[model samples]
Target: MQENEVITDRDNVLFEAGIKLGALYHQFTGSPVNLDTVDSLEKGIQESISVQPCVEKISVSINRDMISSKLNGKYGYCELEGRMLDVHITAIFKTAKVDVSLAFDTELDYPLMKIEKIY
Candidate 1:
């Protein structure tokens, strides 16, 4: 195998993991809150990440915190209707390990959650 080929393969693994994480975030945001949402989300996220050819294992954790009051203008001022959540995703690939943290707010007009940040 050539040196460039090895590097390219590694890059591809990272790229694929990143894309899967983005898709997972999109799937979770703005989703309806229900008894089965958590279960479904976990299953979907795991399945999505694990499907990557380079992925070895994946772990997803979601933390939902209730907003006591409506967010004021200082805090990007959105109506407080749905929950705020922090999603942590870890993907272990054959050549790399990727950790993604996403902050989401689901109170906006759209059914999907608003992405606050990605770390």
Candidate 2:
């Protein structure tokens, strides 16, 4: 996908799922949280989900709102989900950044799979 391309319904659902899952996996696994892992994370996610024919393309976005909160030990996360594309973000005061993970299946409304957190 292009760097600035806007997400659309025509995009592959599995790819979308992989992007979201990859973001969550890296978010929870990183120390000091290197946002660069997003690329590697995306690659890993794509490889795992490539078996699914439904997936076509994938994209991801990260909110750097926490840039100033580093000194304060404050961490934040952003995630989008569902047809309405609800957004949720939370800030926490801790050594590690928070993570946001979500899982879905053929049906959009119900979460068939999920990661522990969404950061």
RMSD of 1: 9.1
Off by over 4 Å in 1: 1-7, 67-119
- lDDT (Cα, tens digit) per residue for candidate 1, span 1-100: 6555455444655566567656766565565443325556656666766776555555654442333233344653332222344444454546556555
lDDT of 1: 0.49
**Candidate 1 clash pair list:** 29-113, 30-111, 30-112, 30-113
Best model per TM-score: 1
Angstrom error of the Cα, residue 54, model 1: value is 2.3
Model 2 spans with C-alpha error above 4 angstroms: 1-32, 64-119
lDDT of each: 0.49, 0.36
Residue lDDT tens for model 2, 29-50: 3333334443454445445544
Model 2 clash pairs? Answer: 99-118, 99-119, 100-117, 100-118, 100-119, 101-117, 101-118, 103-113
